[model samples]
Target: MECDASTIVSGFVEKVVSRYAESIDRDNVAPPEFFRDAAGHGVFGLPIPREYGGWGLPFSDFMDALRLIARESPSIAHIIFVHSMSAYFVEKFGSEEAREEILPGAARGERILALAFTEPGAGSDLASIETRAEKRGDTYVLEGEKLFTTNALYADTFIVLARTGPLEARHKALTLFALDKAEGVEVGEPLDLMGFRGTGLARVLLKGVEVPSSRVLGRENEGFKPAVVGLGVGRLPFASIALGIAEGALEEAVRWALERKSFGRPIFENQAVSFPLAEVAAEVEAVKALIRRTAELHDKGENILLHASIAKFLAARLAVKATRIAVQVMGGRGLLTASKVSRLYRDAKAAEIAEGTNEVQLMIIARDLAKRVR
Candidate 1:
């Protein structure tokens, strides 16, 4: 049975995430208690199936929940999104034994997960990853450094991508593994980020970490497929986060416009203020429609590469635009670092960069259009 989205969203998310968003940003760390509390509320298991100890909600339901959480705290929303995405990968492609072993704990938030796909040299290009996994009898020895690993400090399990073949093989040489933190796995201190803070983002060093053959995710040397599939499916939720940012920014702007008076009248009475807010209000609905439709396609087991890209692309850009307008409406007050509008403004840029950049999304769209016309 599906968990009640309203209950979870209203009761826990608003009370906790909204209350702590500023402190989370100011301290640049989401306390462990935050995650534990979320676990107690089933926030981590919104999309996983009931048999796996999750709520078994649909993708759209999860997105609705994500949007609300992001509106309160984008950092928390992003953290949950990455964690849930890893759980999705495991349940979708992992072996039955692996699922039985990992999913229940992950669903319960007992085992936090991270994606270790990016390297210092391999950012957008997954084929050039320099990490190596050498086979030795029944175990594989992994040695590589993963960069920009979200949840690096807190993740009990990592979904890692390494090269099992020569670099000349390109994407074919890559492999995926589900690795638990061990003696050789070292996590660096969290990096100071401009936005999406408090996520425990850090670099992970794997110095000859060993894993059993059973830990391999999907097939060896064919990991690129599952990686691509997981990333593609992840874009829609990413879009939902951006939608939340836009919604939050707009809300702040509307409040400021209504309250801040200029020359004895509320600033909202001015056409300059009202028109932009009105336009963004309409745009927000458009983005919600797009995300809802894309999420519906995903629930039907349809390919969402192009549609997800569109949703992410538009939503991220709209977030930046909406935040900018909010800040402008607040005038100098919005510039204060402590202001919610300012924080939202800073956080909005990360949406465009993560889940693939706006340029990458455009390229994907262009490539799809090119193929369709031929």
Candidate 2:
């Protein structure tokens, strides 16, 4: 039976959204209690199978949950999104032993996982990563540094991609390892970035980290395929998060516009103000539709790489525009740190950078289009 996306998860998400938003900004870290609450409520395991103690809900329901979380705290949503995406990868591709060992705890919110893909030498070019993993008996000795790893500080395990074969092989040479944060795994100091501050992004240094054979995800040298597939599915949640940020900014802008007076009249009454607000509203709705459609395409098992990239790119771009307009609408108060629009503005930029940058997405789309023409 298909899960009821709208009905089942909305209420739970609404109850926690505002609280998460407030604490996430104040703490500058994902509120540990919030994740525990979500896990207890079956949100962390939204996509995991019931056998693994997850709800195993349909992808639509997962999107709804993500939207709610994003509305409240985009950083928390982002952290959860990355971890859940990793969990999904493990559940889908990892061996039975791996699944049984990790899935239940992760689904229950007892564990957090991070994706370690971006390297100092390679950002958009995954094939250019210089991180190496050499087989040493039954274990792989890993050595490399991964940058911009979301949730690295909090993650108990990481899905690390390293070059397992000759560098010339590029995509075919890479392999994935489900590495634990043990002695050799060094999580660098948390980065203080301009946005998504609570996500705990950090540089991960893997120096001779020994991962057992059982820790390998999928077969050796076949990591790129699953990594790409996981990224495609992951983009939908990011698009939803962007939509939520834009919507939140819009709501704040409207509230401020209606209440704040200029020239002895409410600012919203001005055609100049109202027209831009209307434009933002329309753009937000369009983004929502795009995110939903892309998610549906993913659920249908269609090849949605181009569509995912499009949705992610457009949603991120629109979010930046909408949030900027929101700030403009609110004038001085919008620039204040305490203002909702202000936070939204910061969060909106992350959408453009995470999952994949807008530039990278455009390149992917253009490449796909060129192939079709050929």
Candidate 3:
């Protein structure tokens, strides 16, 4: 029997994933120990099938687990989000042999995976990527640089996108390959960003990296569908991270307002402070409903591109708004780098840009919306 959608992953999330919430965010380097601990507790195994040594919870349950992780540390949650893109692509398109080889170690956290697609010139555009792969007798040699790889610094393997056909072929020329970082692959230092710090974010330089034919994730030159599916799956959890940020911001702001007294009474008593909190609270709830609904649709195998974009777009914007409000309520104290409010503020902005930028999401939504209207 399949696992129930609820209660399957609560314990590990509550006990193990939340344990390093403070330290994970505070440390400059992401602690490898946290990944090991999370793996030992079976957090990584939740999404894998039972046949492959995983608990095999429903996708909705996986999304719910991500929400808990996000509440603790969206940085960690963001890392998992990128990993999901790799995991999903491998599971859906990789050979049975490859799945058997990769999924078990992945479930155990012995192996970490990341996707390398974006480049300096190609942020939202996938077809224009300059990375190219040349097919030889039995291997495909790849060479190029990928920017903004969330787990590149420590990932054991990368599912990279490279041009296999021709630039004139546009997106159809793109192919996905799961290549080991062992040979010909160089991982660069993490980018100094405003948020999602310590995610092992870095540039990946692939110089003549050779991939065995078997490591190709999907049909050669036909990876566009898988890439789109990965993005769709990603939007659900990415939105959840934004949701957690909004919720955490609301919690922090409310506490700060209720305690920090003003001229006559608590700051919360002042409409100037209280009104924004109330407004943000209402908005967060709306985003929460949409997020949950989106996840449920995803679990049902429904086409969720439009819904996912709506959720992500709203969640990112709302999270940033709420975090800013939290900082406002906390005043000077919120500006401190050490404060959770400050962290939330920074992470909220990052949410809008990662996965796909808010602008990209809007473009997708507008295009889809036009179809429905016509």
Rank by lDDT, descending? 1, 2, 3
> Which clashing pairs does model 1 show?
none
- Across 212-246, the per-residue lDDT of candidate 1 in tens digits comes to 89889989999998998799789999999999999
Give every collision pair in model 3: none
Error of 3 at 165 (Å): 1.4
Best candidate, TM-score:
1
**Candidate 1 regions with alpha-carbon error over 4 angstroms:** none
Model 2 misplaced regions, further than 4 Å? 1-15
Writing each residue's lDDT as its tens digit, candidate 2 over 1-374 gives 44454554565566665667766776677767777766656666778888888778767667767776777678877877888899988888898998898889888778888999999989888988889999999999999999999999888889999999988999999998888786478999888887787787999999889888898999999999999888976887888888888887888889889999979999999999999889988988787787777777778878777877888898888889888999999888999988888888989997899898999889988999999999
TM-score of every candidate: 0.98, 0.94, 0.94
Runs in model 3 lying further than 4 Å from the true structure: 1-19
Model 3 TM-score, all chains together: 0.94
lDDT of each: 0.90, 0.83, 0.82
Considering every candidate listed, which one attains the maximal lDDT? Answer: 1
Better of 1 and 3 by lDDT: 1
Can you write out model 3's per-residue Cα lDDT over 155-179, one digit (the tens) per residue? 9889888999888898888888888
